[model samples]
Target chain A: MPRHELLTGNEAVAHAVAMAKADVIGIYPITPQTTIIEEICNLAANKTFSPKIVHVESEHSAMATIIGAAFTGVRTFTATSSQGLALMHELLHWAAGGRLPIVLANVNRAMAPGWSIWTDQNDSLSQRDTGWMQFYCESAQEVLDTIFLAYRVSEQVLIPSMVVLDAFVLSHTSEPVEIPDNETINKFLPNFTPSFKLDIDNPCSFGALLRPQFYQEVRHKLNDAMSEALIKINESDKLWKQLTGREWGIVTEYRADDADYLFVTSATTASTAKPVIDKLRKEGLKIGLIKIRVFRPFPFEQVKKYLTKCKRAIIFDRNISYGHHGIFAQEIKSALYGVKNSPEILCYTGGLGGKDITPQLIEETIIKGTKTKLNGSLFEWI
Target chain B: MPIKSYEVRFHGRGGQGVVIVSKIIGYAAFLNKSYIQCFPEFGVERRGAPVKAFLRISNQQIFIRSSIEKPDCIVVLDPMLLSQHDTLAGASSDCLLIINSRTADLQIQKSFNNICVVNASDIAVQNGLGTATTPIVNTAIAGAFAQATEIIQMKHLEKAILKYSPAKIQENVKAAYQAYNTVSKPIPLK
Candidate 1:
C-alpha cells in the first residue's frame, strides 16, 4: 500500500530519488534547495536509502559528478537553484548532449543582482535551449511523480530531464503526498542498463570531438531524439497512470474546451489561476486555464488545439525574455503562426523575484484583458 | 456547512515555532483526508524577527499556490506582534483572531468581531515547553485555535503535535491540552 504523508516539494523530490533507486546523487547546498540535499542525506543515514551522496564544493562540480556517475550506466541525481543552476550551465549542456539520462530538480528562483530567495521561472527558462527535457510541476505530488516519469522518458530517448518546481512556494510548502512503495517503483522503473557506458573493458571514448563532417549530423540526430521523446513522454505518462493512477499531461487543459477566454501560464502561477478562473466562470464569464507542464519538447499540438476556440488568451509569465515579450507568449505566438482565426494573445509578465501572484491580481488581469482593445499590443506587465 | 477552503495566517517571532504550528494544523487536516498546504513568508533568518506563516485547508484539492492575502483565521503566537505589524490587515470582520495574550489589547478588541484569547505563554511555561522568558507558545496557541474554531479535532491535533513537535513531545502535547481547556469564548468587539 502507498503511504500517505505530508512532505514539502523538496522532500518529495528526495523521496522520489530514493524510491527510483538512484545509485548516486551530487549535492551542493543552496537556500530553498538545501532541504532536498538534507533529506536525501537523512534518508541515507537512516539506512532507508543507500545511494552514494557526493558532497561537491560547487554546483558545477555537482553536475560534473552526476555526469561522471551516469557515464558508468548508473541512475544519478542532483539539485540546485538560481545561481547554483547558472553555475551548472556548461555541464547542463554536457549531460544532455552526452545523453546521460540524469535527472535534476531545479527549484525555480529569480536570478540575483539585488539578491533574492523567491519563486520565479527565470532560472530554468534561462536554460531553455540546453536540450534537456523540462517538466514544471505545480504541486509536491507532481514533483515526486514527475521525477519517475522524467527518468522513464529520458532513459528511453537517451536525453536528460529537469524536473522543476517553484522556489519557497512549493519547496517550503508542506502538502499531503501519497508515497509509492519501493516494490511498486522497482516494477515501474528498472535498473539503468545503458547500451553505452564508461567501461574499461570496452574502452570507448565518450563525448569525443567530432569532425566538421559529422557535427551537424550529430546535432540533427539530437533534435530527432527530442521529437521522438515527445511520443515517449506521453507514453511514459500513460504507463505511470496505469501504475499509480495519476498523470500530469504535457499541456493540461482545465475547462478550456469551449471557453471564449483562456488564462495560459506555467508552474505555480498556473495553479494560482485555477481558483480565479473558477470564480470568473461562476460569474458566467467563459474563462478557463491552460497549464503548460512540459516546456521543452514543447507541446505545440496540444497548445494549438486548446487555443483554437478561444477568442483571446491572457498569458501570465513569471519570467520575461527581457528585450522580447514573455517567453511563453513568444512560444505560443510561434505555435499559432498562420493558423486561421486564432485567438489574440495578451501577455502580462511579472511575479519576478518571488512576488506574490494573488487571486485578486489574477482576477484583475482577467478584467483588464477583457477591457483591452483586441490586437492593440501583445505585451504588458502586472 | 463545512468550509470548502479556509486560509489561516500565523504571526509570531522567528524562534517561537510559528512555521511548525502551521504544519501541525496542516497535518491534522491531512489526517482528516482534507487537502492542506503550509508555508512561511520567506524572510532573513534570525532569532527574534517578526515572521509569518500560512495554512490552507480544503475538501477539494488546492490549486492556488499563492500566499493567503485575505485570511479566514489569524493565529498570533506572540501578542507583541499585534503592535508591530498589521496582523489583521486582510481579515474580514467575522474573521477569527486567536491570540496568545492573557488579555486582548484595547485596539484589537475594538478591531475584530470575533476574538479568542489564551495565556499560551503561561501554559507553555507550566508544562516546561520553553524558557519563561521566551516560551514556545505555538502548540498552546494551536490548541486554543482548535478549541475556538472547532475546525480541527483535538485527537487529530494531538497526533500532529506528536509527529511534528521538535523536542519534548509530552510537554508540548500537555501544553496544547491545557490551552484547549482554558481558552476563552469568542469575545465580541467592544
Candidate 2:
C-alpha cells in the first residue's frame, strides 16, 4: 500500500533514490542540495538503504564518480546546486557524451557574484547544451515523481537526466507526498541491465578517441538518441501515471483552452502564476498559464499547440542571459518562429537572486504586458 | 466554497530551532489531515543571528510555492527580534502575533491588536530543553501558537512534538503543554 509521509523536497529525492535501489550515490554537499545527501546518509545509517555513498571533495568529482559507477551497469545518482553545478559543467557533457544513464537532482540556486544562495534558473539553464534531459519541478511530490520518471527514461534512452527544484522554495519546503510501495516501484523500474557496459569478461573499449572520419556520425547518432528519448519519456510518463494515478505533463496547460493571453513560465513561478490567472479570470480577463515541465526536450510542438491561437503570450523568466534575452524567452521565440498567427510574445525577467514573485507582482506584469506595444523589442526587467 | 488557508511566519534566533518550529506545525497540520507547506528563509545562519521560517496550512492542496508576504499569523521565538522594526512588516491589522516574552511590553501592546505573550524561554529552561543562555523555545512557542490561533489543537501538537522533538521528548511535550496552559490571553491594542 502507498504510504504518505511529510517530506521536504530534498527528503523526497532521497526517499525516491533509496526506493529505486540505486547501487551508488556520489555527492558533494552544497547549500539547498546538502540536505538531500544528509537524508540519504540517515537512511543508510538506519540500515534501510544500502547504496555506496561516495563523499567526494568537489562537484566535478561527484559527477565523474557517478559516471564511472553507472558505466558498470548499475543505477547511480548525485545532486548539486548553483556554483557546485557550474563546477560540474565539463563532466556534464562527459557524462552525456559517454552515454551514462545517471540521474542528478539540481536544486536551482542563483549563480553568484555578490554571493547569493537563493533560487534562479541561470545555473541549470547555463547547461542547456550538455545533452542531459531536464525537468523543472513545481512541488515536492513532483520532484519525487520526476526522479523515478527520469531514471526510467534515462535508462531506456541511454542519456542522463537532471531534475530541478528551486533552492529554498521546494528544496527545503515540507509537504505530504504519497510514496509508492516497493511492489509497485519494482514493477515500474526493474534492475538496470544495460546492453553495453564495462564488463570484465567482454573487454571492450569505451569513450576512446575518435578521428574526424566518424566523429560527426557519432554526434548525429547522439542527436537521434535525444529524439528517441522524447518518445521514451512520454511512454514512461504514461506507465508511471497508470501505476501511481498521477501524471505531470511535459508542459502543463492550465485553463488555456479559450484564453487570448497566456502566461509562460517554469518551476515555482508557474505555481505562483496560477492564482493570479484565476483572480484575473474572475474579473473577466481571458488569460491562462502554461508551465514548462520538461525544458530539455523543449516541447516545441506542445508549446506551439497552446499558443498558436492566443493573441499574446507573456513569459516570466527568473534567469537572464547577459547579452541576450531570457533563456526560456529565446527558446519560446524560436519554438514559435514561422508559425501561422502566433501570439505576440513578451518576455519579462525578474525574481533573480531569490526575490519574491508574489501574486501581486505577477498581476502587475500581466497588466503591464497588456498595455505594451511591440517596438521591435520584446524584453523588459520586472 | 473555496478551502481556507492560513500563512504563518516564525521569527527567532538561529539556535532557537526556528526552522523546526515551522516543521512541527506542518506535521501537526498533517496529522490533522490538512495540507501544509513549510520552508525556511534560505541564508547563512549562525547561532544568535535572527532567522525566519514560514508555513502555510490549508484544507485543500496549496498550488502556490512562494515565500509568505502577508502572513496571517506571526510567531516570535525571541523577544529581541520584536525590537527590530521589520519583524512585522507585511502583517495585516488583524494578524495574530505570538511572542515569547516573559512580560508584554507596552510598545508591542500599543502596536498590535491581536497579540499573545508567553514565557517560552523560561518554560523551556525549566523543562531542560536547552541551556539557560540559549533556551530552545520552539516547542513552547508552538504550544502557545495552538492555544492562541486555534489553527491546531493541543492533542495534535503533542503528538507532533513527540514524533519530531530531537531529545528530551517528554520534557519538550511538558514544555509545550505548560506554555499552552500559561500563555497570556490575547490583549487588544491600546
Candidate 3:
C-alpha cells in the first residue's frame, strides 16, 4: 500500500537517505539546506533511523568526514548550500578523484556578493567541472527518488553524485509525496557494495602525488570513468523506474512531439512551466518543455536527438555566469554548435535571488522568444 | 472535473516555522486518504521576516500550481505580519480567518465574516516551551479547523501528530482542546 506524506524537499532527501540505510552522515547546517540535517538529527534522536550522525565544525570538515567514511567502505551522505558548498569545493574534487561513491544533497543558492539566501543554480552549476554527477530535481517526489537513484548511480560508476534542488523554493516548500514501501525500495536498491576500501591487511596508497607521466594517466582514468558514468546513470534510472514505477532519466520531455518551439529548464522551474505548457497547447501553439534532470555528463546526445529538430528553443536559467549569460544555456548552445539545422537557441535569465517564476512569465517568455527576430539579444528579465 | 479542493494560507515570520503548521494539516488530511500539497513562500528576511505557507487538500489530484490567490481559510501565525500587508486579499467573503493575537478590537474583528482569535503564544509559553516559535498554535488551529468544517476527525489528527511529532504531544493536545472551546465566532460590527 502507498503512503502519502507531506514533506519538504529537504525532508524528502533525508527520508530517502534513511531508506537507503546510509551508515554515516557527516553534516553541517547551512541555510535552506539546514532543515535536512535537523531532520536527520531528529530522526537519530528518536531512534527512527540508526545512521551515525557526525556533527562537524564546518562544511569543509563535513565533506572530509564523508570522504573518510566512504573510504572506510560505509554508505555516507551530507547536505550543503551556497558558500558551504563553496567551502567543500576542494573535497568535492577529492571525493570524485578518490572514486568514493558519496551522495550529497546541494540546495542551490546564489553565491554572495550581497549576502543573499535565495534560490539560484549557480552554486552547483559553478562546480560543473568537479567530476561529480549532478541531478536537478523538479519536485519533492523527484528529490526523494533522485537521492535513492543517486546512491545506485554513484556506486555503479564510482563517481560522487550531487542532487540539487532550488534553495528556499524547493527545499523549504512542502508537497505531498508517496513514501515508497520499505520492501519495494530494498528490492530496488540492494545493500551498497564498495568497490574499494582502506583495509589494514591490504595497505594501498590513496591520493598519492604522481609525477607528470602518471598524472596524465590518472586524469585520463577519471575522464574515462566520467564517460562511463553517462551510461551507468541512464541504466540505473531505467532499473529504478522498472522497480518503483517512477520515471526519471537524463531528461524528461513534456509534449515534445510536433513541437516547433521548445523551452528548456530544470529543478522547480520545470514545475512552474507545466501549467503554461498546457495553456499554450490549448491556444494552438506547438510548444513543449524539456526538463534537464541530469546536468553532468551533459546528456548532449539526448539533447540533440530531442531538441535539435525543433525550429527554435529558449534556455531559461536561474543562475547567471556574470559576464556572459546563463551557465546552462551557454553550455546547451555550445553542445549544438556546428550542427546543421539546429534550433536557434535564445537565453533568458530569471528567478535569481528567489524571484517567483509564475506560469504567466513562462508563457510570455516562450511567446516572445519564438517570435523574436534577433539572434543573441533575446536575453530578457521576466 | 469535480472541484472539491480546500486551500488554506498561513502567514507568519521566518523563525516561527509557520510552514510546519501547514505540513501537519496536510499530513492529517493525507491520513484520511486525501491528496494534499503544502508549500512556503519566504522573502530575504532572515529571523524576523514575514513568511507564508499555503495548503491544498482534496480527494483528487490537485492541478493548481500557483500560490493560494483565493484562500478559503487564512491563518495568521504572527499578528505583526497582518500589519505589514493586507491579509484580506483573495480572502473569500465566507473565509474563516484565524489570528494568533491578544488584541480584540472591533476594527480588526470586522475585517472578516468568520474570525477566531487565540493567544497560542501564551499557551505555548505556559506549557514550558522556550519560544512560541511555531507556537502550540498549529494544534489549536487544527482543532479549530476541525470544529469549523469537520473535514477531518479529531482521531485522524491524533494519529498524524503521533506519527510526525516527538516532543510535547500531550501539551499540544491540551492546547488544541483549549482552543476549540475558547475560539469565538465572528460577530457583525455594530
Candidate 4:
C-alpha cells in the first residue's frame, strides 16, 4: 500500500532527491528555495541518506558544481529562485549545451526592481532558450513526482530539467503527499546510467571551444536533441503514471474540452484558478483552464490542439516580460500564429511581486477579456 | 469515521521560525507513525513581519488543502500577533490556546475550556538563550501543548529535539520542561 503523508513542496523535493539516490547535491540558501537545501542538509547530517551535500557560497557556484558533477556521471541535484536562478543563467546554458542531465528545483520568485519575494514565473520563463526541460508543479505531490520524473527525462534525452514551484505559495505550503515507496520509485527511475562521461583514462575532450564554423552545427544539434526530448518527456510521464497511479501529462487540461474561453497558467496559479473556474461554471460560463506543466520544449502541438478549439483564450501570467506582455502569453501567441482558427488570445498580467490573484480577479478578467474585441494586437495587460 | 483529525496553527513573525516549530510538532507525530502535515504562510512581509504556520495530525489521511480556518489549538509566538490579526478566528470552545506574552492581565473575549498563557520570552532569557525567539519558545510551547492535551508525550518532544537539534540540545530540553510548569491554563472571562 502507498503511504500518505503531509509534506511541503520544498520538503517534497528533498524527499524526492533522497529517493532518487542522487550522488551529489549542490545547493545555496535563497528565499523559498532555502528550506529545500536546509532539509536536504539535515537529512544528510542525520544519515537518512548518504548524498554528498555541498553548501556552495552562491547560486552560481551551486549550478557550476552540479554541472561538474553531472559531467562526471554522478546524478546531481540543486535548487534556487528569482535572483539566485538569474545568477545561474550563464551556467544553465552551459549545463544544457554540454548535454549534462542535472536536476534543479527552481522555486519561482519574482525578479526584482521593486524587490518582490512573491510567486512569479518570470525567472524560469526568462531562461526558456537555455535548453533545459522545465516542469511547473501545481502541488506538493506534483513537486515530488516531477523531481523523480525529471531525472528520467533528463538522463534519457541528455537534457537538464528544472522542476518549478511558486515561491512561498507551494514551496512552503504543506499538503497530503502520497510518497511512493522506495522500491516503487527505484523501479520507476533506474540508477541514472550516463549517456557519456568525462573519462580521464580514455583521454576524451569535453566542451572544447567551438570555432564559428562549427558553432552553428553544434547549436543545431543541441536544439535537435531538445526536440527529441519532447518524446522522452511523454514517455517518462507515462511511465510515472503506470508506477505511481497518478496521471501527469506535459500540459494538464482542466475542463478545456467544449469550452468557449480558456485560461492558461502554471505552478500554484493553477490551484488559484480552480475556485475561479468552479464559480464561473455555475454562472453558465463555458470556460476552462490549461496548466502548462512542461514549460520547455513548449508543448506546442498539445497547446494548439486544445486552444485552437476555443473562441477566445486568455493567458494569465504571474511573470511579466517587461515592455511587452506576459512571457507565457507571448509564447502561446507565437505557437498559435500559424494554426488555423486559433483562439482570440488575450494576455492578463498580475500577481507579480507576490500580489495575490484571487478568484474574483480571475473571474473579472475572463468576463472583461471575452466581452471586449480589440483591434490590431489581441493582447491586453490586465 | 470515528474521529477525524486535529489541526493546530502557529502565529508569529518571519524570523521567529514559526514554520520550523510546527514542523517539529508534525515530525514528532510522524515519527510516532501518525499521519501529519505542516506548512507556513507568509506574504511580502520581510523579517519580523507577522507570519503563520499550520499543522494537521490524524490517525487517517488528511485531504483539506486550505488554511486552518478552525484550529483545535492556536500557538502564538508573539502576543502582539493576537491583537494584530484574528489568530483565534475559528477556534472552537474546547480549542486550546497557547500564547507567549509578557502581559499577565491580557484576556481573551471568548471563554475557552482550555487555554495556556506563558511568558516564554522571560523563561528563555532566564535560561541564557538570547532573545525570546521561536526556538526557545517552540520547545516550551510544545511542552505546554503536551501538558494541555497530552496529544504528544514530553519524551517524544525531547526525542525529536535531540534528534534534529545539534548544538542547543540541553538548553532546549530545559526550556521545554520549564514551559510545562509555567504555562497557565485557560481561565473563564469574568
Regions more than 4 Å wrong, model 2:
B1-4
User: What TM-score, over all chains together, does every model reach?
Assistant: 0.97, 0.97, 0.88, 0.80
TM-score of chain B of each: 0.93, 0.94, 0.84, 0.87
Q: Write the per-residue lDDT of candidate 2 for residues A1-382, one digit (tens) a residue.
A: 9999899999999999999888899989999799999999999889877999998899999999998988889999999999999999999998999888899999999998889999999999999999999999998999999999999888988889999999888898899999999998888887889998899999988889999998888878778888888788888889889999999988888889999999999998988888888888999999999999999877888889998979999999999999887999999999999999888999999999999888889999999998898866489999
Poorly placed runs, candidate 3 (over 4 Å)? B1-5, B12-17, B43-51, B58-70, B77-82, B90-96, B99-105, B108-136, B149-151, B161-171, B174-190
What order do candidates take by DockQ, descending? 2, 1, 3, 4
Ranked by DockQ, the better of candidates 1 and 3 is: 1
| Per-residue lDDT of candidate 3, residues A1-382 (tens digit) | 6677778889999889988888999989888899999988878788777998898899999999989989988899999999999999999999998989999999998889788888888899888999898999988899999888889878877889999988766787767888888887887678876756888988877888889989889878888888888898777778777776787878778898889999998888887787778788889999998989888878888888877779888889988988888887887887788887788788999989777777777888998897889745456666
On DockQ, the leading prediction is 2
A208-320 per-residue lDDT for model 1 (tens digits): 99999998898888899999998988888888898889989899988897899999999888887888888888899999899999999888898889998899999999998
lDDT of the structure predicted as candidate 2: 0.89
| Deviation (Å) of A306 in candidate 3 | 1.6
The lowest-lDDT stretch of 10 consecutive residues in candidate 3 chain A is A373-382
> Judged by lDDT, which candidate is best?
2
* Model 3 interface CAPRI class: acceptable
Reported per model, the fraction of native interface contacts reproduced equals: 0.87, 0.79, 0.43, 0.23
Per-residue accuracy of model 3 over B1-190 as CA lDDT, tens digit each? 2254798988877756566677777777888888887877755546667778888888876544556777888888777766555566778667878777767552453356677777777766666544645554567666666666567777787776666555788877766666666665544333
lDDT of each: 0.89, 0.89, 0.81, 0.81
Worst 10 residues of 4 chain A by lDDT: A373-382
Q: What is the interface RMSD of each candidate, in Å?
A: 3.1, 1.9, 3.2, 5.6
